[model samples]
Target: MKRNIKRIIFVVAAVAVWVGAFFMTQRLLEPKYMDDLIEGALTAEYYDETTKHDVIFIGDCEVYENFSPVTLWENYGITSYIRGNAQQLIWQSYYLLEDTLRYEKPEFVVFNVLSMKYGEPQSEEYNRLTLDGMELSPVKIKAVEASMTEDEELITYIFPILRYHSRWNQLKSEDFEYFFKKDKISHNGFIMRADVRPATTFPEPEPLADYTLPATCWEYLDKMAALCKENDIELILIKAPSLYPVWYDQWDEQIVEYAQKNGLAYINLLDKCDEIGIDFYSPETADTYDRGLHLNLSGAEKLSNYFGGWLCSNYQITDHRNDPDISAVYSEKSADYYAMKEDQLRELSEFGELKSY
Candidate 1:
C-alpha cells in the first residue's frame, strides 16, 4: 500500500508538471501582436467586446481599414464591429459569420465582395492573421479546414506551439509582455492609420481570361446568405472603394446578379465615390496610407460618415449612443480613439512618418 501510494503521487506530480510546462511553452511560442503584425490581433479582439453591436462587418483589410465603427457610433449613434483581417477569403468570411452568430445576432451584416475573387486559400500567413484569433469551436474548425493552404497542417493550428516553437530565436520583449494578456489593438475591430500617402502610379492590372468568380466562392456566398436568412439577419453586400485590385465589370455583374437573385442590397461604392465626397485622384482630399490600396484615417472617417447616413436611411438600426451603459463604454473608446489619433499625428510630425502602428 505504501509503494502504491508513492507511485500514485509520483504520477500525479509528473502530470501536473507536464501540464504547466506545456502551457508555459505554448504561451511563449504564440505570436504577440503588441508591436508588429497588429492585424493578426484584430480578429481575436472581438471576443473582448463588452457591448453588442447593431452591425457586424466582415471581409479583408478593405472593411477594417476603410470603415470606423467608432465613427459610426459617434456620428449616427450606430454600433458596429468589423471582423476583418488581411486577405480574408470568402470561406473564412462565411465561417466568421457563423462564429459571430454563435454570439449576439446583429441586425445587419456587411460583407465586402472582394474576397469572392479568391476561390482557394491564399497564404498561410494571412490564414494565421484571420484564424489564429478565433476561439476553438466547430466554426473555427470548419474555418481552419476551409482556409488552410497546401503548406499548412491542421495539427499546427490546434497546437500552435508546434508551428511557432522554432520562433524562440525571434522572441522579443512583446512576447514576454503580452504572453498572458494582450493589449487592445483596435477600436471595435477598426484598425486606424493616421498617416497619408497619395495614390501613386502602379503596374496596371493584368487582364484575366476568365473574370468569373470561382464556384467555391459562390458556394460560400450562398451559405452565408442562407445562414443570415435562417437567423433572421439582413446581409448587405458592398464593394469598398479601393482604387486598385481593379473591380472588373464582370465581377460586379455577378455580384449584382447574386444580390438580385437573393433579394439582398448591394452597393458598389466604387461607383459612388463622387457622391460620397471621396476624391481618390487628389491626395489632399482623400488620403491613403499605402498608395491607394487602403484608406488612411481621413478617408475612413469620410467613408464612415457617408455610410452612416445611408445605413440610417435604409435600415432600422437603433442608435445606442444614448443608452447610459453603451454611451459610457463608447465614451471611453472615443477617448482612446482620439488619443491614438493625436499620438499618430505627433509621430508623423516628429518623424515625417508613422513609427508605430
Candidate 2:
C-alpha cells in the first residue's frame, strides 16, 4: 500500500511539471506585440478595466482608429470602450460581442459597417492579430473556427508555441521583457497617431460586378442585432469616414435599408464630414495618418465629440464623471491619453515619424 501511494505521488508530480513547462514555453514563444504590430495587444487590454462602460464599440480598424473613448468621456462624461482589431470580420465581431456579454452589459453597442465587405476569412495574419489576444472560452473557439483561413490549423491556436516555435532564433528583447506582463498599447482601445499625412491622392476604386454584401455577413449581422435586442442593448450602425477601399453607394443603401426595416439607427459619417469639421485636404489641418485611411488624434476627437452628443440626445447614457469610483479611473486614463499624445507628437517633430507610439 505504501509503494502504491508513492507511485501515485510521483505521477502527480510529473504531470504538474509537464503542464507548467508546456505553458511556460507557450508564453515564451508567443509574439509580445510590444514593439512591432502593437495592434495585436488591443483586445486583451479590455479585460483589465476596473470600471464598467456605458457604451461598447466593436468592429475593425474603423472603430478603433476613428473614435477616441477619452474624448467621449471628457466631452460628455460618457464611459465607453472599443473592442476592435485590424480587419476584424463581421462574424468575428458577432463573436466578440458574445464574449463581451460575459462581462458588464453596456447601454449601447456601436458597430462599424466596413467589415461587411469581407464575405470570407481574409488572412492568417489578420486572424492571429484579433484572436491571439482573446481569452480562452467557447466564444473564442467559435471565433477561431469562423475566422481561420484554409492553411491555418486549430492546434496552432490552442498551443501558439506550435506556430511560433520557429521564432526561437528571431526573439527580441521585448519577448523576454514582457514575458510575464505586457505594456498597454492603446488608450481605451484607441490607437493614437499625432502625425498628419494629408490626403494627396487615392487610387480609383474598381467597379465590383456584385454590389451586394454576402449573405454570411448579413446572417452574422442579424445575430448581432438579435443578441443586442435580447440583452436590452441598442445597436447603432455607422459607416466611418474612410475615403479608401471605397464605401460605394450600393453598400450604403443596403445598410440604410437594414436599419430602416429593423427600426435601427445608421449614420454614414462620410455624408457628415463637412458638418463634423473633418479636413482631409489640408496638410496643416488634416486628421488622417494614412491619407484618409484612419483618423489621427485630431480627427478621432472631433468624431468622438460629435458622436457623444448624438448618443446623449438619442439614448439614456449617463454622465459618470461625477461618480467618484468611475471618475478616479477615468482621470488617470485622461492623464495617460494626454501623455501618449505628447510623446507621439514629440517623436513626430524630432524624427519626422512616430517611433514609439
Candidate 3:
C-alpha cells in the first residue's frame, strides 16, 4: 500500500510539472505584439470583446486600415469588429468567417475583394500574422492547413514553440511583459494611424495573361456566402479604395457578375472616391499613411461615415446608440479611440511620422 501510494504521487507530480513546463515554454516562445508588429495581435483581440457586434468586417489590411468600427459606432450607432491582418488570404478569410459564426451571428459580413487576387498561400510571415493568434479549434486547424506555405509545418502552428523557440536568445522585454496578457491593440479592430502620405505614381500593373480570379478563390467565396446564408446573414463585398496594386476592370467585372448572380451587394469604393470624399490626388486631402496602400485615420472616418449612412438607409441595421447598455460600452470605446488618436498625432508631431503605428 505504501509503495502504491508513492507511485501514484510520483505520476501526479510528473504530470503537473510537465503541464506547467509546456505552458511556460509556449508563453515564452509566443510573439508579443505589444511592441512592434502589432498587426499580429489583432486576430486574437476579437475573443476579448465583451459586446456583440451587429456587423463584422473580415479581410486583409485593406478592410482593417480602411474602415473604422469606432467611427461606424459613433456616427451610425452600428457596432462592428474587423477581423483582419496583413495580406490575409481568401481561404483564411473563409475559415475566419466560419470561426466567427461560432461566436455571435452578425447581420452583415463585409469582405474585401482584394484577397481574391491571390489563388494560393503567399508567404509564411503573413500566415503567422493572421493565424498565430487564433484559438486552438477545428476552424484554426483548417485555417492553418489552408494558409501554410510549402516550407511551413502544421506542427509549428499547433505548437508555436516549435516555430519561435529559436527566438529565446533574442527575446525582448515585451516578450516577458506580454507573456500572460496583452494590451488591446485596436479600436474595434481598426489600427488607427494619424499621419498622412499622399498617393504618388506607381509602376503600371503588368498585364496578366489571365484576368480571371482563380477557381480556388471563387470556391472560398462560395463557401463564405453559403456559410453566411446558413446563418441567415447577408454578406456584402467591397473593394477598398487603395490606389496602388491597380484594381483592373476585368477583376471588377468578375466580382460584379458574382454579386449579381448571388443577389449579394458589391460596392467598388474606388469608383466612389469623389462621392465618398476621398482624394488621393490632393496632398491637402491625403488619406493614406503609406502612400496609397492603406488609409489613415482621417480617410477611414470619412469612408466609415459614408458607408454607415448607406448601411442604415439600405439595410435593416438599427441605431443602437439609444440602447443604454450598448451605448455605455461604445462610450468607453470612443474615449479610447480619441485617446489613441491624440497619442498618434503627438507622436507624429514629435518625430515627423508615427512611430508606434
Candidate 4:
C-alpha cells in the first residue's frame, strides 16, 4: 500500500513536469499564439505603440465612444490609444492603470468618472474582470516599485491573487496570448455609417434614484488618484455626455459633491450636448445599433472632432492632420464620412433640444 502511494506521487510529479515543459516550450516555439491572443484585440489593428506625451484614455465603452486614437493621431498630432473595456469596474480600473503604466507612460490619464458613479457588483465581477482581462506590461513592475507598500503591491500585481483573492483558476497557456494581445489597436469603432431610428429619449435604466456608491469602489478610485499623484501623471476626470433622462436619474448632487471633493477636473457635457453639437433627437440615430448604448460612425466623428478641438484647446497637443500622409488617409476616409458628420452637426446646431442635468 505504501509502495502504491509512492508510485502515485512520482507519477503525478512527472506529469506536472511534462505539462510545464509542453507549455513553456510551446510558448517559445509559437510566440504568435501570444501575439494572436493579445494583439490588435481592441482598437483597429490592435496594440500600436505611440511616442512620449501621447494621451492615454482609459475607461469602459465611454472612452471608445468619446475618443478615436486614429482621429487623435490625425487631428491632434499627439498619438493616443484607448484602453477601454466593456462593463469594467473601478477595481478593474485600478488594476488596468497599474498594469498599463508598465509599458510607455503617458503624459496624462483621462479617467472616466462613470465608474465612480457605478453601483458596485455583489458578485466577484469587480475583481474577476480585472484579473481576467488584466494585462501586465512594463508598467506593472514600475507600479510596484513606486507603490507605497511595494511588497504587497508587487505580490498582488504579480499574482493578482493577493488583490483578487477569489481568482482561484490559475492562468493556463491560453491566457498568455490574451495578456500579450491586449495592447493591440481596435479598428471597429463607430464603423457603421447609416443610422435608422427615431430618437426621443431613454428611460432611466432603473428608477429615478440617487446612486450610493460602494466603499470598495471608492477605495479603487482613491488608489487611482494616489497612483496618478505618485507617478506624476495628470488625471482628468471627465463626466461625459449621455441622454438627459438617464443622466439625471443616474447622477445627482451626491455625485457632483464627490467629484468636487476629489478635486477632479469635471467636464459635464450633459446639457452641453448641443454646444458640442449632436442631433440626439434626429430621425436617424445609432439607437438602431446596440440599441442605444454605443455611438455610431456619425457620432464617433462628432466626438473625435469635438474632443480633437478640446485636446487642442486645453491640452498641450498639436494638430498634425495637415501632414500629407495622415491627411491623405483622413481625406480619403473622410469623404462620405465628412458629409454625414457635417450634416449631423448642422442638424444638431439647428435643432435645439439639449436639456440640462
Largest lDDT belongs to which candidate? 2
Tens digit of per-residue lDDT, candidate 4, span 97-182: 77667666777787776666554443342233224333556543543333222224455555543454443354456455543343
Give me the displacement of residue 251 in model 2, in angstroms.
0.4
What's the residue-level lDDT of 206 in candidate 1?
83
Q: Supply the TM-score for candidate 3.
A: 0.98
Where is the poorest 10-residue window by lDDT in model 2? 280-289
Instruction: Enumerate residue pairs that collide in model 3.
Output: none
Estimate, for each residue in 1-357, the C-alpha lDDT of model 2 and write its tens digit.
Answer: 999999999999999999999999889989988899999998899999888888999999999999999999999999999999999999999999999999989999999999999999999999999999899998999999999999999878888999999998998999999999999888889998888988988888889999999999999999999999999999999999989879999999999999999989999999989889999879777989889999899999999999998999988788988999988999999999999988888898899998876
The CA lDDT at 55 in model 1 is 93
**lDDT for each of the candidates?**
0.90, 0.93, 0.91, 0.54
Measured against the true structure, the TM-scores of the candidates, in listed sequence, are 0.97, 0.98, 0.98, 0.61
Worst 10 residues of 4 by lDDT: 31-40
lDDT of 1: 0.90
- Clash count (model 1, backbone only): 0
Q: What ranges in model 4 sit over 4 Å off?
A: 1-40, 43-53, 122-133, 136-185, 188-201, 208-210, 249-252, 285-288, 318-357
Q: How close is candidate 4 to the true structure, as a TM-score?
A: 0.61
Candidate 3 on 170-288: residue-level lDDT in tens? 88999889878899889989989888888889997899899999999999999999999999999999999998888999999999999999999999999999999987656755888
- Write the residue-wise lDDT of candidate 1 on 1-357 in tens digits: 999999999999999999999989998989987899899998889998888889999999999999998899999999899999999999999999999888889999999999899988889999999998899898899999999989899988888999999999999999999988999999888889988777878787789999999999999999999999999999999999998888889999999999999999999998887787776556555568878888889889989999999999988878786799999999999999999999999998999888988
Candidate 2 residue spans exceeding 4 A from truth: none
Q: What lDDT, from 0 to 1, does candidate 3 have?
A: 0.91
